[model samples]
Target: MKLIVTCLFSVIMVYSTIAQNVAISDDGTYTADNSAMLDVKSTSKGLLIPRLNSFEKDNIPLPAHGLLIYQTDGEEGFYYNNGTPSAPEWITFTDESNALWRKDPNKNVTYLSGNSDSIGIGTDSPSARLSTDGMIEAMSDGYKFPDGSVQATAVFPANFSGYESAADRRWVIAMCADEIPGSWEYQGFEECSKVIDLEWGIYVPYEPGGGGVTGNRVHKPITVIKNIDKATVRYIQELVEGQGINEIEFHFFWINPDTQQKQVYYVITIGDVKVIDFNHDVTHVGNEIFSHVDIISFAYEIIHWNWLPDGIEFQDNAIGP
Candidate 1:
């Protein structure tokens, strides 16, 4: 009885060891446990395999469509297509009209679009998917200006007095006296002492009365002196005949005292008469004559005769005297 019991006990121990080395599911099929299995092949009864976690080719069951499964607790789950599983946290589906679907924080989706096959993470287009390093690639294409051009206008400061007519009032002068050599000298005069007279006057407009005496002064024609750095004369010459510049004219006007009639005279100052080809050019000449007349002194005077009443007042009506 002792010998039979010893043999039975030995056999029981061996069976127990084998049972500990293998794993059995509820289906009655066995698989290798955590140990004692390496490079074993599958059989009809079971698979003599390594541990399920250690086996490189183990068939992992994928989750159903639209379903998610997790490998470890607290980790995001992945989706499955057919029997094949994807990386953890893979996208399954997203709402088409939702902007949050396009701006997902985790960035799990691969392709993105408004369709069902697309999974948006940060953008509505498929090209906006995140790179491998979890960085969102910029998909903004450069844009051009709408009309392909830029426009600007030249502006001058308000304090600039170069174009103001009121600032030119100081140029008007009646007469300037200058001392000259004198032929005869006093008793104590030095040798070669002489005296002469020099006078300069500016042209000014005056109304002629019935007595021939001018009255009711109107416009003043004064010589404008400009000290334009080193290129003063050269600059003035260029402006006189440059592109788009036609003939320049100096205008003189006289108004009658009694009838207030006015008469105007024009003299060609620079450029040719043929240069006035267009009406626009003529208008430009008018502007230039009003603004840019500088240098060169002119002389004029008025002769008066008492033919009308001294205190008479007249209303302006006539076109010319």
Candidate 2:
């Protein structure tokens, strides 16, 4: 009993002596730095801070100001709460500045300045009253301008004519189509045909001859005539009759230049008449046809009656300005 009491008394004295400063080091004799509450010194090791994910770090209850922790996810770095416990503002110690925008308690809104300064959302530098690198969406509210004018949801004009000054509407459509991939391909092109269909429009770039030692090739658009039908199936039938071949099997792939969608074409020439017949029944099969003539007819109806085409998947409905 006496030995037990003596050991407890010794432990208390050692703790009391080290209460002012605590030093952890390889060598037991090293003293702690006077400024730091707990000093850890090592030559071959590093001081590891508490690591937590964004969810765990944010859920810390009443975290004190100046509390530091290493976050593992969502802009991972060391974070310290600069604000008080009741209104903690945890900011990254890694490259975070005092002028950095502060997210509100709801976390939905972020504010860089309270007043007397320009505000920026997606950009750090602001050249105007409000500058953003991304789109600004106003949900269930109208926008008010500096001129004291309020604007609600804008609707397109009833008689709106697009690009009144432009000479060609197709050129404008092509320009708009260039911004997005898979807008359209050559019309009446087969989805599985191996040959390149010239009907779909293929732009081949070539260098023009000029008065120079070496000709530098420059790309330029060339006008092409769509006259493949003039090749005359009658001429092909005459040649086939001379050879006495009753049936000639031929398949061609066609791509819609406007939609970039491929359509399959299978043709069989019989006798000297060169009569055309589709493998699938015209009326038996569904509206979706892989034949060239059928697709052209379908496109005509789509443009004439403003009907929707099949196999079109929609994404975010945004038009470029």
Candidate 3:
């Protein structure tokens, strides 16, 4: 109480006597600068500001606008209230408007320091040098495994650039086609019987003209043959244009409901030649070919709609040497 009274008395006396800018200094030669309201000059010592935690800082009664304070807890930094005394908004001095990488207060796990430190993503207590509890996606520069094995984002053979294999083609086809739930047979062509048996392939009826018989009602299969054909043709074009050798051996068959006979279609590229051999002998139609590209085309447009490119047999049977 005595100390407070003495300090208040001293301030009153100093205000009464000094009409000019106030200067607090130990040296006799030091004088107050014209621009400054109060300047405290020190050589060895430093001026100590009021330090408070986030809770204590908030509790400060009627905090004036532009009130400077040093926050000692949470994201520790010098803070200044930019808002009015009625509604104060404390802003950190370190937060730059133009900074690319800024501290996010909402995220509690990110830890940064001056020294060599471990970075933890989605985790506070990191175990390794760089630990992450979530999936680490590598976009451009591919990441490495714990065993030091590198996994690139895109992997392609040196000779076959942008050349997707039969498996990739099948995957694309499967992805584009309508998915049959559970087993492959639910209202689709998977339950259909194979019409013909080749050395390395089996021709399955994708669309048997109309729907197949199931119990009382006839379940119609989703006609994805056209989509499958377009995808297959596009894949073939890509393979041929990329100068990659095609090793695809697949059959698409259309069954006639009248005679129970099947019209077969063979699609495979040996070197650069895209072969779509249509078995017209079953229909007694002559073998007529169309200009597929400048290189290859098909004449039997009716059979093109019946193609169902599925379960491709990846055989080493190349037509040319």
Candidate 4:
């Protein structure tokens, strides 16, 4: 039975109004400094603050601001109430990351990294930065993807990042009899009747090479073109002279959808890197044929329509912008 009189939880105290000083001690010595209203000292034992397990700690009724305790539950450590009576919050100290992570009495991951400066979610080895193995959500603000983008204005969320843009582009439709790469024929070609029965119409990027250096070199060339029939592709992407609008690039990753091979590509969406080129070949079944059709059709369309005015030019070059 511990007996304390003056203060509810005090151990021992001595006062000398004549000396104009007060002192409290557990080892029978007045070691408190003269300028203190309260001083506690123990030589053989340590002072105990409010200590409770996770559940017990959470049940504090109307805990005042700054209420602190040492929790002995799931995320065992010291915790503090972030000031709320209805739904008091308990912030925990994690030893693994050696930081204080915010905890809502009922939730696990309140904040990423548990307060660590560098945080990685899916992977244990987080970059000396930040990484999430999933999509991030923002209310309605603009965004900056991992690849790269060309914005119509100086804002973000990329007004145009190879997703959709019709400001300065032409349209063409081509179709092929089968999935065979050699059977693709543009809807409109000159000098002869169409031999390939490839009927495909989709806006393809003919505009590339405007933004300055992207550190991506012109990959190895693919050159094999026959009159109206293209077996290969090459050449200069249109270079916008001034303003921020420059080149547009389409990155291709060969993948076969018929066979469920590696799911790496499907797990994530692409749109924010720094370069574009022929990289990665994932086989499922008929991906190569479809890719061939796209390459040939768009290649010729770009050839016939690139750099031409928005509409047809009449005699004497009288036209509209």
Candidate 5:
């Protein structure tokens, strides 16, 4: 009885030690590591995990989030659990030369596809090089805003050349440069008092070397682009055939719908030289008044030369006596 009771005590101690950790050895010895619950040590063969066919894998019982297994039949590869404990799903992490690649279940609704030339968004089969089902945005507003209404002011620069001389003037006619002849209200005409924005300037014409070495003064006329833009200015001369100044071809006036005002476009092509205009304005005005040149004289009379010849110049300064 003492021997039997001693044997039972030894068996109990052995089981208690095995409960903490269990290790299997090829030499038929059970060894355990201090940190791990179970460890297998072998030199001949490796441990084979449970292999499953597609049908058998689908029939798994309750699966946890971190469950792992190896598929044996179709798409033979390793799979991991990407689902919860209740609703578990096995997903292939990676596929080498002998594996398969599947789509993400989360991105099933919106797919992404691309090619060498172009990429497609929200589509699988793209017809064009780069096709997209979403709206696109641009970075420039130069062509977007044809009227230069946003992100830029339409006001033009002051004619510095016009101030060079009282007799010698550089006047830009606005009514001649209209794409379609018409006038609209200022964008914010209500903000101004009864007065409107005036884009007016002065221009006079007289014959050079008329009476003597100086010249002769002719009746200078002031032309403006009012409502209909039919006004005319005539400066008749005796030396040459006097023609109607209103008949001179220029661009007509135009109005911008955004500002609801007449856009002040300058005279670009006056016979030959096309003037590049950088000025625009939207000043409110009720009417443009036209008046005659009051102080007319033969002394230093201004010549009405629209454009100079190729070699000749307008303001050629050469230090004369």
Candidate 6:
């Protein structure tokens, strides 16, 4: 019995030494001896068992897997599942290649390309071209009349003929013009009294060339009466007494029938009266004496000329010799 107990204690010591000798290699594979206990100093390799007393099935192939790792000086090292043997820095699936790629558990994939210093994903191709010359030409090519020109002419109404006559219904003719200051002269009429028996006369307001140059001129005629009676004179006086009469002075331009030079006719009417101021005393006049005097009515007429041409050019000032 003493010899059997000593043999059991020696077996227990050997088993304890084998269990503590188990080790793993640098390639992540484990190795051990076939004994139920692992061997520490045994140089020979064999099937790896994960732990002491763990079960092992013989002749079964070991499962194999791979990992890709990257190393840079300043960046942390990481691993990818799809890296190829040729370009371990880039990873690819069956369809596309990616560098520094990752996919989350939700299946979203991201990748980086270009210099490792900068990175981009989901970007492709480049941008489309504008004309600077056409704009400059349009701005360069973009209408450029004199002073004191006139546009239209002046006209008078069509129905105007002349003023009504005072004597025998015959129309009186007259014309008006601006007189030069010293050039206006009057002949064959009393001062302020324009009545005259002559065929023609002139009224010039200045001493022949004083006031200014004439702008417009018109022609008109006067009505005349041959014989009148005293009763008619009295009746005419009754018609015109106390009524205001217009004092019209005339400047007439008459063409000589032979010489053809223009001669001016002037006349003035002071008080075109219906009543005669007889010098004879009204109380002393016998009925027979009053029978001889006669009354006459007279008026001036205006004649218009249409011969003046439109757009006539004239000197700014009248020419004087």
Best by TM-score: 3
Candidate 6 Cα RMSD (Å): 43.2
With a 3 Å backbone cut-off (N, CA, C), the pairs that clash in candidate 3 are 290-297, 291-297, 292-296, 292-297
User: Runs in model 1 with CA error above 4 Å?
Assistant: 1-59, 62-67, 71-89, 92-321
Per-candidate RMSD, Å: 28.8, 23.3, 21.1, 19.3, 19.9, 43.2
Top lDDT hit: 3
Error of 6 at 40 (Å): 99
Off by over 4 Å in 2: 1-19, 97-321
Q: Distance from true position, residue 35, model 3, in Å?
A: 2.0
Candidate 1 residues 126-236, lDDT tens each?
532331212222356322236422221111122333221132121111111112111222222211111111122323354457445364434222233322122234334
Stretches off by above 4 angstroms in model 4 are 1-24, 34-37, 95-232, 235-321
Lowest summed lDDT across 10 adjacent residues in model 2 is found at 296-305
Report the C-alpha lDDT of model 2 over 104-221, residue by residue, as the tens digit. 6787887775444787777789867776654354575434447322221122112322111222111101100111122123232211111111122123344457544443322121
Question: lDDT of all the models against the reference?
Answer: 0.29, 0.40, 0.42, 0.36, 0.39, 0.29
The parts of candidate 5 lying over 4 Å away from their true place are 1-19, 28-31, 95-321
**Candidate achieving higher TM-score, 3 or 5:** 3
lDDT of 3 at 302: 12
Give the lDDT of residue 131 in candidate 4. Answer: 59
Q: For model 3, where is the 10-residue window of minimal lDDT?
A: 170-179
Clashes of each: 14, 20, 4, 19, 25, 31
Candidate 5 lDDT, tens digit per residue, 196-242?
A: 11232333344466743433323222232232211111111211232
lDDT of 2: 0.40
Q: What's the lDDT for candidate 3?
A: 0.42
What ranges in model 3 sit over 4 Å off?
Answer: 1-19, 95-98, 103-321
